[model samples]
Target: MNSLFHDRVRGLNQAPLRPHAQYVLYWSQMNRRVSGNHALAHAISLANSLKLPLLVYEALTCTYRQANRRLHTFILEGVPETAKRLAALGAGYVFYLRARKSDSNNTLYRLAENAAALITDDYPTFIAAQHNSSVPAKLSIPYLAVDSSCVIPMNRFEKREYAAYTIRPKVHRLLPEYLKPWDMPVLRQRWNLPLPAFHTEVTAGNIDALVASCEIDHSVAPSLTFRGGALEAEKRLAVFLDRNLRRYSTDRNHPAAHATSNLSPYLHFGMISALDVALAVERHGLENNLSSAEFLEEMIVRRELAFNFARYAGRQTECLSSLPDWARRTLLAHATDERKPCYSREQFERALTHDDIWNATQKELLLRGKMHGYYRMYWGKKIIEWSPTCQDALETMIYLHDKYALDGRDPNTYTGILWCFGLHDRPWGERSIFGQIRFMSYDGMKRKTDSAAYLREIAWLESTGCEPHPLQ
Candidate 1:
């Protein structure tokens, strides 16, 4: 194994590598792209060491909670590109789509039976996290997971970081060592084995039909503003670099400016590696004589902080119990405080809140499958204000994100939602519903941001289901 990826690789099980195995299995659970993938590269190294071919396995099942058209379509959209890339790299690709409960779920086990060792993504949230914990025990071969999600592997941090400030310096200090481009290794043996019978063929043309065939919630549609795939992710990054990078520092907070990278969905889905994005931004910044500090802070520092939180927090990642002492005390102290106009989760989902900004933000999540990072704070704060209790507020935010937001169920999703409740945040001056937790008001949003322009843009999306800005 390469020393660069040593910390990123973790053998989850003690099973020795199978002596007469046919291939090395790289299960694509979270990180799905071929480029800038530490896990895939690690798998190649193992295959070369064993003098065996590599088989990459990817699957999308209908069993996960809130499996819907939006999520399914986005993931399936990435398949054609992934298949092409894997083929070019001389690796076999098997993409399984378990569209119904009756479908066989043993695809992985079947593939693992002949594997030298099993490699997978070391993600901390959603189905990938659950699979990493349980599947390793069941496999007869060695089970390894590689952390390809974060630029700096999550293992480098010994414990959970309280906030970005604590992690920022550590991340910056280590960037020079890890931020370089990935030199994808050559495969020693080509994948000559036949694919399994259960493999589903995915193409751009059949994606809609494939998603429609899935036994998932059909009402929630695919994101109108974003598409999936490594190609699309790279395109979005290019646009951000060419058009938005210069403005990112001054205008990222303004939803109307469209200065932000809008790459959260891509990042969360592992369509692109954070390492790739970071290097691209850094290189672009240096060549253009522009400052990439603010953007890098959010992408590397803040994002990795979320991963650190998710890794240590474990199952409590989404629970209010994961909050800091000050946050828990403040929220509990104000638990009984009366909400002026409490709304049901359904109402919030429907974007029926009296506040225009809040409703627009929800609508943006509905239409775009993501909200602007800055306004998301306001969106969360308002949810806390209108919900009956802090716990209720927390549940509502998670449920909404899990079901609707393209970037939902991510470490950032949980951290950002919890930040609304003061996780990784310091206590502020006393307040009514929020206690010492930070609060945002409609007036504050209106004063600081271009609320009117955002409203108009969202209104356009709501009416036309089309992006008013070409690059958005």
Candidate 2:
């Protein structure tokens, strides 16, 4: 059950290889990077064993829900680097950009025409989940969905965990065996085959034009702060270790301190692997006498807990039924207890609520495509407080994330939203609109952190049309 080599591989379809195929096909779905990638390594190994060149196929289609300029640009930003890395590793890279609904949707099927085996990323949510379930049966070659997303492969968990505490001991115990560094396997054969007809070469100067050519919604703009891709991800991580790791424990909960690693978007996109990040942080922490235990816990234990839940729950990941019996009961009991103020989804979206702090958080989400982690809890809690119902609040949160957040639609995103409804959480003292669910107060946030500073920072960004700390 080794995370890197054994348990990471999951056989989906019972199919034989294509006879006299030209090359092995590797589909980059979620774990999009070339290094610290167990799936890519597996693809290379199979290709080497079969004495065939490897062809890596990656695609971006404008057909998914809420397809917009922001999402398209971010994904396109990673393509140039991916092409460079795959070429350096002696693998042929084919990038298919399906720009419209009319564009041929059969790129994968077309690429698989002469492939020996089909290998793709094993992911729990979004389009990857749908593809893994549906595409395997259609292919004539062996289909594999490798678990390259987790530091410890999600298959290591036998059952859904109740909470972080229950999974913490088990995860820590397995950490030593799986936590070491992994280098991508070298390939014996170089890809020399002509690229497929559908391939589109991505370049830095043409990303905007390429995204503009897509049929996705053009209204939503790219993030004002974060850039996408492996190089950008690596750069941000080095910056975090050099400056912010020491302050992570003490000031992580404060929004304006900038004391935390702003690596969630890269982590979400798989541009940076958790295994790589953890190893670097641990080395830096030891050398500097700074404790990285807290950061590691969030990165490993809590993050994987989300994966475990998503892997086990299936389609119920977004449904409220995924909540525990206690949570459902508590939320149901207080469903009708609201009376003071109820706002529509539009109000929440516009940041029209009475609370300045909550509005600031939403503005951050709107302008930067992500919000600070600490205030994000406040943002969710306030939605539950102001919206017409808990379900409404849930829908609003999911909608905003799906549309705007760089890290939205992830397992952690859904799990964190559900945490506001008391999922994976214990019952707390009863209140009017919240029942036994744990409640966060405005006074509590104001007391523990300097809200004024955060408000000022966001105000500056909103006025200037940029983040206080833009990557540029």
Candidate 3:
């Protein structure tokens, strides 16, 4: 393999490549796109070196924790584009939809049976993380995991970073070398074999029917706002560059402004690469004479800090125990603080809270499958203030995100939710329910943000099932 991708790749197993293997298998566990994928590029390099055809395998199963119409539809919608791209690259493509728990689950192992070496995505959280940890040892051939998710590879940081400030300088120091465009290598050998029997063909028209046929949660519908696939992701990125990049630094925190790029779902699902977005934004900013600093801070430094947290924290990423000493002690000290008008999980899920701002945030998650970052902080803080206990509040946040947010079960999701409980943060003035943890009040949100406009927008979305404006 080329030394350019050395830091991004990690060999997960000791097994040698199968001597008589027909092709190299690249499993699309995450980093699903054909462009800007270091793992796929690395696989092509390996395949070319071995003079073997490359085969790419992707799957969506009903077995993951919150399999539902919303999640399944988004993933399935991306399949046709992926198939087309892979085919154009002269690589074989296979997508398997295990619509039922009883369906065959040995697809990866079966594919590996003929593989020279197995290449997969190296993600720090969600199902990808779990699979990376356990699946490597089970494979007979070498299993290599690549860090294609971050602009600066996650492996560069040896330990969990304390905060964005600690990691920012390091990220900047390395940006010149890592932020350049990825040159995906051409395949030397073309795949000519027919696709496997388990391959489930996905098309733009059959996505809804495919999602409907799945025996997963039927109640939660697809987002009324965002669609899945690389095409949609690219379109949204183009819109941000043309209309919103200049305004992003000023109005990203203001939910109603719609200045921020609504690309978290794309990022989480790997439909779009962070490197691709960062490069585009930086180039646009340079040509147009606008500062990309603020946007890149969130994209690289802060976002990678979350990946660093998940990398070291491991299974504790979602738990309160992973919090710093000050945060845990402070929360434990205030554990018994009474929550006036406390709410149950059901009430929170149904958006039945008395706080209009909080309810609006929840409604945004329901309708758009994501909430604006600024209000999400308020939404989480209010949940901490209203739930019966701190643990209950954490559970509510995770449950809601897992069930509704398109960006749920992601490193950013865990980091953002845990931010409500003071992870990667400092102590503030002592408070009632929140103690030293920072507090967000209804009046504070009203004073700082365009809460009235946000409420009006959410109300319109709920009533009409459509975005109130073209900007959104």
Number of the candidate with higher TM-score, 1 or 2: 1
lDDT tens digits by residue: candidate 1, 250-351: 999899998999899999999999999999999999999999999999999989999999999999999999999999998888889989899999999999
Instruction: Give the residue spans of candidate 2 off by over 4 A.
Output: 1-4, 470-472
Superposition TM-score, candidate 2 onto the true structure: 0.98
Which of candidates 2 and 3 is the stronger one according to TM-score?
3
Candidate 1: residue pairs that collide: none
Per-model TM-score, in order, reads 0.99, 0.98, 0.99
Candidate 2: tens digits of C-alpha lDDT, residues 381-448: 98998888888889999999999999988989999999888878899998888888889999999999
User: Could you tell me the lDDT of residue 159 within candidate 3?
Assistant: 87
What lDDT does the true structure give each of the candidates?
A: 0.93, 0.90, 0.93
Candidate 3 residue lDDT tens string, 287-406: 999999999999998889999999999999999999999999999998898899999999999999999999999999988999999999999998899999989999999999999999
Off by over 4 Å in 1: none
Off by over 4 Å in 3: none
TM-score of 1: 0.99
